[model samples]
Target: MSSDLWSFSLSTYAQPGVEPACLQLQSAGINVCLLLCGLWLGERGVAFNEHRLQQLRSVAEPWDAEVVRPLRALRVNWKVVAADDGELNALREQVKALELEAERHLLVRLERTALSWPQGEATDLSAWLNGVAAGAAHLDRDALHQLRVAVTGT
Candidate 1:
């Protein structure tokens, strides 16, 4: 695993909650391919990086695009909330759940993507391990274990 990537992901999780965590992960080089898919599904005006989308498309299968598009759109829309305090907390919880679901789906997609890797591209196992190491620093052992299982299908 790349220590640089591991440190990056770990730093992101050290933040408050899911959105900040997601933002941090993005900053730290988490796959924005799904985020790009979200953009294709009408998630414009959110300031996603175009180069990241191109990287995602490079590794993605044609069918995977269809699968990820709606999921990414759902993730984009799920982050919206009203102004009420009570409603805001509820929205936060819902967003957290959605983020977790998105991460799970990303894990599956990454696993599939790993299978078709080119000669020098890093393996999914290394990436998963890096994510796990990062997650372990912030999440509980149980949550870390769950993430491991999600990523590795074990």
Candidate 2:
């Protein structure tokens, strides 16, 4: 297992079905970065609680709303138009990169927030996943299961 949240996220994302699962969850208004962080916390055996869930959300929601989403919106908006325009395509690619970087930063922030939390106190992975996913509308259970199975093999 990776030692840090960012590395864990990259490793998990590379697993089969994980990318699509994450995308599905994201499309349902779930924050993929937060989901990944919850997975990492579970993998590390960190205890889950409402306060910790809110703490992570506090760090993730704003950055995602203000930074990541805008870049992603621009990139997605340009996708079809950029298909025929090389210049716009290049800019769209840059926006994609920026969106990824923003997510990376959000992961870093989440890791920092969770760093001081004790680990190995809980092994209920579902608790962490559910806690992180709780408030989202139209939560995709299949996607969440795919993510859990892909990462934890459970």
List the lowest-lDDT window of 10 residues for candidate 1: 39-48
lDDT of each: 0.40, 0.92
Q: Residue-wise lDDT of candidate 2 within 1-154, one digit each (tens)?
A: 9998889999999999999999988988999999999999998999999999999999999999999999999999999999999999999999999899999999999999999999999877899889888877899899899988977798
Summarize candidate 1's per-residue lDDT along 29-132 as a digit string, tens digits: 34443432322221112222344334444655443455544555564654554344566657666766765565546544533543333333332333333432
Q: Which window of 10 residues has the lowest lDDT sum in candidate 2?
A: 128-137
